[model samples]
Target chain A: MDFVNLGRTGLKVSRICLGCMSYGDPNRGMHSWTLDEAASRPFIQRALELGINFFDTANMYSLGSSEEIVGRAIRDFTKRDEIVIATKVFFPLNPNDPNSGGLSRKAILREIDASLKRLGTDYVDLYQIHRLDPNTPIEETLEALHDVVKAGKARYLGASSMHAWQFTRRSIWRTCMAGRGLSACSRITT
Target chain B: MLPLCAAEGVGVIPWSPLARGRLARPWQSATTTRTENDQFGKGLYGATEEADRRIVDRVSEIAQSRGVPMAQVALAWMLSKRPITAPIIGATKPQHLDDAVKALDVKLTAEEIEKLEEFYVPHAIAGFK
Candidate 1:
């Protein structure tokens, strides 16, 4: 497998990242066609054998079971430091709970811990927002993510499945913040 | 997304380069797990199925002449784009994985690439919903 640095970061990842959306208990999640642990293990093992060290999953995938399966599979087959694991947040985990979704400070802080616990890891290589949350202020989301990086919970921040203009707005905001001489992931009380 | 990502040096990883099996199979009988499960995909590609078939037909023609699977030719066409870092292929079987890896070797000419793209009309963005 070919290796490439993710974004501008020094994190080297395999060109082929094994997406774990399909690995989890089919009975426990939104997707009816997901694979159980028994069926998912071989695919994870095969991907590792093929020299793919990068794996991506999300907290909401299979209702958190995907993270569990992926974590167990990686631990069983490879060393912790040898692979790059990416998981996403921002989706609602509980429909009854108002605090369960979006990129708000409360949600990001809560979800990262929940994800790390499920993944059986102290830190994730990358933590991403699963989608854009229009309800939450972008600054709050960024600051919360910055806190995650500062606390050593995640090595990098990423966003997924958003419009180009949305991404551009976030990117521009980040640049402006940087230009103001703010440190990476500094605490913002907003 | 491709050009903007290229300009920013952000690696572009494309999902569903085969349009969730739409490009791999004949348009009339097209149906996959995604088409069945994902209403978003149905709305995205299903409406353009007739127009997109022109591109898929070209891909099928190339694949038949070169003795490669249709999926490989389609994947090769995606790989031919410079800004793409990797095409994230969803493989259920080992053979699916093998075919995807082989797509790296199926080279297409400039003319073939142009012919394949000639019929593609823009549609509403999918995948971000």
Candidate 2:
């Protein structure tokens, strides 16, 4: 019910973001526990009724069904501009194609469009790296993400579950390049 | 990580704040379809179960004393952290959302916060590279 600025951005997001990883086609993804679309809709509706306007999902969650289901639910339950939708990239969706994942310029560019298509939105509120790509250089990833923001594909950027040094390195790179830094960072604090 | 994010003014949105439902219940008290089958979730806490169990037990103790659900206690603890902007809460059940929202109201005392946090030993980085 409470809204706060997302990092230093003027974009206000709900203090409780409804994570959409639990909603997808149960038969499609590795997460057998995922609720099917029929089961998932009520929770999304409830979250909206409870004033939760921020929703987080990933391009890989339920192999893209999560994004589809969430996209529909948001369209049915609320206005697109009223919600802060965050999703991540990385993790190969196609086992046959190594280009399907990571933070390379190719991967980032390709995945952003794929994610937008799946979510049925022209732009996402926040686009994030699901994890640091050891395979790709940080500058390539950062520049590609800067391009994403410049293209108006995403309003802000984020990274999840990376080392502090990796984050610091990316921050320094952003400063040097005079590019956009991350607006948010997600970590697993159990 | 929290300190650095705070200094840089980057919002910290923690995922799995309840540790994939581990912190929302008594230690090893129940198993959901997710807990039993989520390989990713299993990888996260398997190595540090002993330390995590102690933290879960403390969460349970505080929840009972406060007459609230264990999920609220765990979320209240997360909400107490200064740099945390929002916790990404995964809800399969409707009550999960209610519990997360109510956590905003369940403020913990400094002593309770200390008790909840004291058992956390350093964990090997599990979720990402």
Candidate 3:
């Protein structure tokens, strides 16, 4: 597989990133057609054999069973340093809890720890906001993400699926913050 | 979007580059296991299947002439576009991955690309929501 630099980061990821959205238990509430852990292992192993070192998943995928399956497969097949793990946050893990979702500082702090534990890793290479959280202030979200980086839970930050203007504003805010010698968002995408 | 990504040096990773197997075998939507199981793909491509069929037919023609799988042709077309760093392929079978890896070699001519694109009609974007 071909390797390319992921944006401006020092990380070199395989061009063909294995998306783990399909790797979860079907019994989970997310979707009816997901592959179970046993069914998912061969696909992950094949991807590794094909030289794919990048994998993407989300905390809410199959209620976080996707992360668990991916983590177990990666640990069994490859070394920790040999791969780049990317997972997303910003969605409600528990619908009953009002504070369980969004880009709020409290949610970010709570979710990252849960994701890290599920992935069986000390840190993730890229921690992304799964969607735009209109309820939370952008600055507050960035500050929380910066704290994630500072606390060594994640190395970089990413955003996904927002209006162009909102994304531009977020990108500009991050750049300005970085210029002023503060933590900033690393990428705006999707 | 391609131009902006290029100027910013951002790598574009195209998910569902095969359109969830629609481009590979457009007619297979009626019976394909993936299409049956993929509610997202059904809503996204199945709604516009008629419009996209013409594009799929052209891809099939090109693949026939080149002696390659339709998935390879579709993937090669995406790779030919500007600012695409990678096309994330959903390979359920080992052969699917093999087809994707070989797509890097199936370069389409200008005429072939124009033929494949001429019949495409835009519809609502899916899979993001």
* TM-score of the B chain in each candidate versus the native B chain: 0.88, 0.97, 0.91
- Per model, kept true contacts as a fraction are 0.18, 0.80, 0.22
Instruction: Single out the weakest 10-residue window by summed lDDT for candidate 3 chain A.
Output: A179-188
Pairs that collide, model 3: A161-A190
Candidate 2 or 1, higher DockQ: 2
Report the number of the highest-lDDT candidate.
2
Chain A TM per candidate, in order of listing = 0.91, 0.97, 0.92
Model 1, span B4-120: residue lDDT tens: 555555555555667777777665575556567855556657677778888888888888888888888888887777556566666555666667667777889998888888997
Compose the digit string of candidate 3's lDDT tens values, residues A1-190: 7787766556687767677877888877556677889888998898888888878888998899999999999899999878888889988979999999899999999999999999999999878887878899988988888888889998766655554456566557657777211111222233
How many angstroms is the interface RMSD of candidate 1?
8.5
The best-first sequence of candidates by lDDT reads 2, 3, 1
lDDT of 3 at B103: 83
Model 1's number of clashes is: 0
Sorting all predicted structures by TM-score, with the top scorer first, yields 2, 3, 1
DockQ of each: 0.33, 0.73, 0.36
Best by DockQ: 2
Which candidate model has the greater TM-score, 1 or 3?
Answer: 3
Alpha-carbon error at B53 in model 1, in Å?
2.1
Expressed as tens digits, the lDDT of each residue in B1-129 for candidate 3 is 445556555455656778777778746645655566777667766678777888889988999999899999998898787666667676666677778777877889999999989987766645444
lDDT of 3 at B83: 65
Worst 10 residues of 1 chain A by lDDT: A181-190
